[model samples]
Target: MASESLIKTSKYTKYTSYKKISYRSFFVGLLLFIVVSLLFIVVFNAYSGSSPRTDFHEPVNLDSTLLEVVNLKSDARLSSARVSNCTYWDCFNVYRCGRGGHDKITIYIYPLKDYRTESGTPFSQFSKEFYVILDTIRHSKYYTSNPEEACLLVPSIDTLNQHSFSKKHVSQALHSLKYWNDGENHLIFNMLPGSAPNYNSVIDLNTGKAIIAGAGFDTWSFRYGFDISIPVYSHTAEKIDSSQPDQKNYLIISTQLNIPKHYLEVLQNIASSSNDLLLLDKCKMDSDRIDYSKRCEYTTGRMFSYPDVLKEGMFCLVIRSARLTQAVLMDVLASQCIPIVIADSVVMPFNSHVDWNRISLFVPEDNVKNIVKIVHSVSKERRGELYWQLRWVYDKYFASIEKMTLTALEIINEKVFPLAARMYEDWNMPEHIYGPVNPLFLPVTAPKAPGFTAVILTYDRVDSLFTLVKKLVRTSQWHEARGATPAVHPMFTTFIMCDANRS
Candidate 1:
């Protein structure tokens, strides 16, 4: 009987110890949970004041007006605020753009000549550039098939390569479109837009009210608000991917054929004397080629190709010849070679949005003799900065056919609908400054960027200083509590403390 009693006692003791351990573990976990919760709250409160937030109001079961600001009534605004569903570009999602902004700035692409559609390589395409332009818009947020609902219209005719597309053929086709209406509300994309032998800046077509988004717009030809100056895109912009050389072979490279005798002489003199310039002319005959094709060659038995050769030079010369706008400008930029543009009164592509002076060196035609000294005068640091900036610009705006087409569309979208326009920083600034943005929402009223700075000057009063910081923290909490995303500016705090002990 004593043995049985001892066994029961031992079991009872084991059960009690297990219960104690359970209680201890529960309490430890509870403590950790509380600590973590408090840390998250503190971090949230600290960061509440300086976060970037854009305000938007989405009404459920929205109507069919373009996304509208809460209270904008200007003619510059798209459609009517009261009746439009989607009015802004940034605030569009599948639901908003597909259903709402569909009616806002709706772009309709005219059907191409029979058998030439956007899908699966139409048996014939004007050029890859033409196909790219059509395909991009078709996939964009602004496309529509109902001409009745379209705000902008694009032509189906091929206007990309002037050498291939006859001006007469394009004009006749454009005139016959079912919705041409004398080219009213139409936007045409033309890279090289005139007849050759003397490719005039004029499009040489009866475009009527159509806006020319062409590359060859000199100051004399570009109608300020009516036209858009677009980039002369390289045929092989995407294929070339070269890392910048640690050391370049030439300070400047000029591959312009058919330049004036004086200009050619000047370049040759610079090349021979300083050995810093490379003047390349088209190969009169290539023993390597059984067929004749373009290959730039220097007289000293050195042959070169555009862009590839451009990578070997620090700067590429873009001088005015028969044409003000040249393919070499975009070519050099893509190769990360700085452009030395000498054309006077030439308005560059997307000039309303881009700062060309930031990436290029522009000199007057009269300054041709001092070109060497001018390029030499630039510091190494400046050259590095310019090349890096050029890379950024080229990638964002001119890298591929898709980018060029989309950039033009975005510009036109902004122009017609001023309220839905992209910000200056969106187009010109580096990504790190603002980061990649979808432009999901915009302010309801006049959008104002919010900045906050808290200045606390404490003179020998540690307690008051602490109190001030606590109060500032509470202000951010107030915003958070009000259902607003609180973003304290990154540069939000400045402390000025004078300690009595220091004396």
Candidate 2:
């Protein structure tokens, strides 16, 4: 009160002395100040955009990271080839009070200026894979523009390809985020992470405590129940022509380059004995440097498109090249080519929810010699079944950026709110098989709508009346639900006045 009076007498009066300024003048000036403040608040809100969504029913709470990785069964481990008895949602534990179901998030993009301290940065340095990841999250149902209400956070730094930016600068960018309190509930995505000499499975950027949604994660680097194993995002995979008819002329196709000398020898020996195996090596160019976009030569001089050639083979070889997680895996899946993956340590994308046995054949790195024998063992009928199943699984879970990103979000959301999380069937089942999904779970028996009734009157028809009553008993559960479907005439009660019998 004293400060306000002093401001009104001194500052508000300007050059006028405190004695010269009248009480009316001071009151007028105060009224003008109040009006200006109100206008400022309205303008600020107008520029700030819409209010946060109120549909969320769960409360937000923070806690420690889930540490259930040690207790996981070998079958459920990320590095393990096949799916286990438990779904992805079943294996995780939330140590905190609030994390998912009601969890909402926003993406915080560092401006172009942040990319400066990183490298000789260009706007074009950001790959399409990076744009796809950002677009996928922006279009997700759980994203909120208001950061104040976000329970989780995403950073936009083109981390999809770690080689695109400097690790030190990227770490600095992470630390500069407004909500980054040791990366509590933040998510960092990396599709093609580490670079040359040592192609480490996971990127080595200082992500603090953020959840790593990355590809090429080995069992050692994977946070088991927490971190997500994503597939290498490939435009070739996304651009596969679905309209083309299915064809399988070759038994096994190996298009991978730069394999170990010993592993290459094994594949060569197998190809020598079998006419079905189509092995390809780098094409001989005039110059020493390889053009990656050019397809490898299958025959001496015959060259075909890399992934398109995969469609003609029953099984495509996913050999570990520069990295454990290969772009060829996604292309193989997209082309409906059952993957004979030889990367023994790689955690396949969404391995938690996907029953890899249905879509892929995980061959141990030591079993390179047996790959041909394994392909021959499967009958033509079984191969055809796998072909269709592989396509279904690919389109459902790993088709595009949207499916992959949403899969990660859903997994995290389920981990946080287990009670309201999606069931196993929801994650693995065919979308059409499950029919429609509704958030409201109708009770087995519900309250009746008042004044709604069914009446029946029949004379000398006790036997027929008995049958009718039995039918009604069977359908009683449906009508018991208050406001049940067929809103035209709501059902509630049943009244049967029948003939009095002496029996």
Quote each prediction's TM-score: 0.62, 0.64
**What's model 1's TM-score?**
0.62
Compared with the true structure, what per-residue lDDT tens digits does model 2 show for residues 167-277? 655665566566666666677788887888888788767776677889998887787777888888777788886654545788888887767788888888877777778
Off by over 4 Å in 1: 1-104, 114-125, 165-169, 284-299, 433-503
Looking at model 2, residue 359 earns an lDDT score of 67
Q: For residues 399-473, could you state the per-residue lDDT of candidate 1 as single tens digits?
A: 887888788877876776677777876777687643665568764554222336555677977666655655676
| Distance from true location, Cα of 323 in model 2, Å | 0.9
